[model samples]
Target chain A: MRKFFVLLAGMVLFLASSLTFIYVKGENDSVNDLLSANVDALADNESSGGLDANYHRIDSKCEVFVSAGMQIDIFGIGIITAKADGKIAIDGKVVCQSKGNETCRPVECSDLYSVILHGGER
Target chain B: MRKFPYFSFVLSLVVISCVSQTKNEPNVQGISVDINKQADISEFVSSFDGYVCLETYEECLVNEIRKLKMVGDTIYVADDTKITMFSRRDGSYLGKIHKHGRGPGEYITLTDFDVFDSRLYVLSNVDREIIMYNASGDVLRIINTGEGFSNLSVIDEDNIWLYSSDSNDSMYNFILIGPDADVKAKYDKFSKNQSYTIEDITFCGSVSDTLYVSQYYDNIVYSLHYDGYVPLYRFDMNLRNTVSQEELSATPLSELHKTYKYKESFRSIMHIDRNRHTLFAETWCFLDGLALKTCFVKADMVTGKSHFYICGYDVDERFPLFDLSDVIGYDGKVLISYLTAFSAKKHGKKYKIGNLADISEYDNPVIVFHTLNY
Candidate 1:
């Protein structure tokens, strides 16, 4: 009887651990992507000698699906790339998250998607 | 075995809560704020200067929208090529004229322009010259920049802010003169600091003085708040532009979004008619996806909550300020114009004629909104 109860508690803990991993965040999640260009990719064909300016590029990528109501407020501007095998519709007007108010969180976004672009950066 | 039912219910609850965050609707968990644009524009316009003033310009004169200034009944619209004049009484199309130069139509590509009293201040590409035009559309003076300009905005009628786009991108404030423009003050006191690829600079909505600068290289927007050119908010908000494998393989849609990467930030910003309280914003940023993602959003500064309606599809002929303004006027009611019509590049090395015309795609290539009211 003592062995049976101990085994049951162990099983419960294992189930709880697995469930937590699936529910919350893990190692290679979507938000903390680190894939940005640090070196000046602009005017690389030409030497950086003539120029005296310095700037770095930063970007991140995550393939997981960001269900619907999620919103990311990029103050000035930003873009999100969606990755999937099927037709993925991203609402640009999404209410992911805003870094504005701490205690007060605003929620009124129903759409978020992607923007079409032409040509590479010059 | 006896707790099987309880375990099953708990598991379902956890899954449901996690899945609710990715949709257009709030989780029925957080606080919801109502800011419906379809809610009577008349009541909203009543508070701002009697009539709801709009920046109505000729479509042929502008492709990428810049700045719009309204003074009483006179509305001045600036494009990358020319300055358009309009009357606000009934949103009437007044007179249109190009900046004077070698000949009648001789003018450089205009990025920004400001009109004060009888004078129109213009900023051309390469910081070549600062043009001042009289009320009669005659060139009053053309002042060349020794250091050149990247962008230009109005501080007041006489003080014009000039931003450089050279190897070291920085901005300076200058005073407009009759023939020779002079430096009145150094707005930012920029001293050989390089690390920012300044694309375009504009002020925050309703803030009047706070300047928001976009650095595409850093994927950040620097908020330079007003302290008389001292900068208020230099907050860095992380921005990322991504394109998926599926988007790259899509049909004509894929061919579309890969083009607008010419400037630093490949995003276009437009203002929505602000009601008495909330401020509205819309963006047309489709430099990937092949499909255009049109973003329409509204925020209540007081309540700290916002609502967004994002819709995407092909470059429908009628999907922009042009579409919404179509109902605002008559034959020439809500006018749009392009100063220059030339394509830059598409995807690869080759450049195509860019869409410089402010096209009024009036419900042609259709799109279905995902959230809020369309």
Candidate 2:
């Protein structure tokens, strides 16, 4: 009876240790997955030039659904390209983002006009 | 006799009450339109009357039509720089207004013009002057409107309504000027910076004595009264993309383009016209994701039963895709639009459009006159 009691106590201790190890490992994996997802999202935002708010993308597969020569007029500003090249042109003059800027933002119409007409930033 | 008097008095009181109630009722009707609902263009457009292929020549070639108006058998087609007159009956070239210069009778830019009582009032926005010409193309007089008004509507010989989208004056967007070039009154005092440029051509349109004014960056259409204007109709498009007056005020003028671009917002209301108590507002909406959406919200001024029609997304492929971008004017009788000769020829073959059967791909744009059913 004394030998049986000792074995039972050892088994209980082993089961608790294994359960704690499994719970800790599962939590760590979940945390690592969340971190990886966040990193991937950040990388995508960076690689896309971060103008998701300004520029809209029309998928190439959906291009056939739209009319030919369909233009999105930005209220008389400049026409931002939905193509993958990400080129923005105003009245046939291509205006690029400022140098050394990782992210993109809207270029003012007047600023774009000045750049096109006077060949420099306003 | 005493009973008769009481009855008469009671009748007068009831009449007065009814009149007061009618006056107090809101003139502007709030129309709820679902932009997603696809409607057949044939439901609103009754029949195609005919097509006029504007006679094209080297000397009278219209590079682009900015505004087209018809008056007294003459169709006035104004391009960006010049105005040319063509015969309404046969599309023959009559003459061109080729007085673009800085001289006394000349204008630097022909922004807008109106034909009233055989006189042509041409507004030169850049020059800030209006040169009046008789029917024979003789210069009558030049009125120097102190401000650069981008558009003008001649109410009568005495009153003219002027609108400026490029004014630094934030107090008023419209100025009513008299014959003597004096400021008569001002309307539409928007709080935002009024200097931003918008490319809408028609601001205010008149049918009979009633003139409807479409406010810039606003959804309310107003009827111009003696002192001010009263709201005639409100277009409730239920669009997610809209900028409030506060947002417009808070946003810098330089950043306004960003506030409107690529979003599914009502960019600007163009071609506000009314015929037989039927109001039509050609609303231009930007690209929604991948689809290009343009809608025309037509409402009955009496019953307020509104119809929303989306171009290029009509129910049947047989109907011609009519976008408001090509709409020139909506007369009381017919809604006039034009299609490029290329498009007319192409769509003509596909849809079997009878009016476009005689169209040539190399010819000028075919002017299609549409009669509205609803």
* TM-score for predicted model 2 compared with the true structure: 0.67
Candidate 2 segments whose C-alpha is farther than 4 A from its true place: A1-122, B1-27, B166-171, B190-194, B248-254, B273-278, B290-293, B300-305, B314-325, B352-362
CAPRI tier for the interface of model 1: incorrect
lDDT of each: 0.37, 0.64
lDDT of 1: 0.37
TM-score of each: 0.41, 0.67
TM-score of only chain B in every candidate structure: 0.48, 0.83
Model 2: residue B87 alpha-carbon error in angstroms: 1.9
Q: What's the chain B TM-score of candidate 2?
A: 0.83
- How high is each candidate's interface RMSD, in Å? 14.0, 14.6
Give the alpha carbon lDDT tens digit for every residue of B20-72 in model 1: 74342232222132322223322122221112222334342333334455555
- The most accurate candidate by lDDT is 2
Q: Give the TM-score of chain A, superposed on the true chain A, for all candidates in the order listed.
A: 0.24, 0.42
Error of 1 at B319 (Å): 11
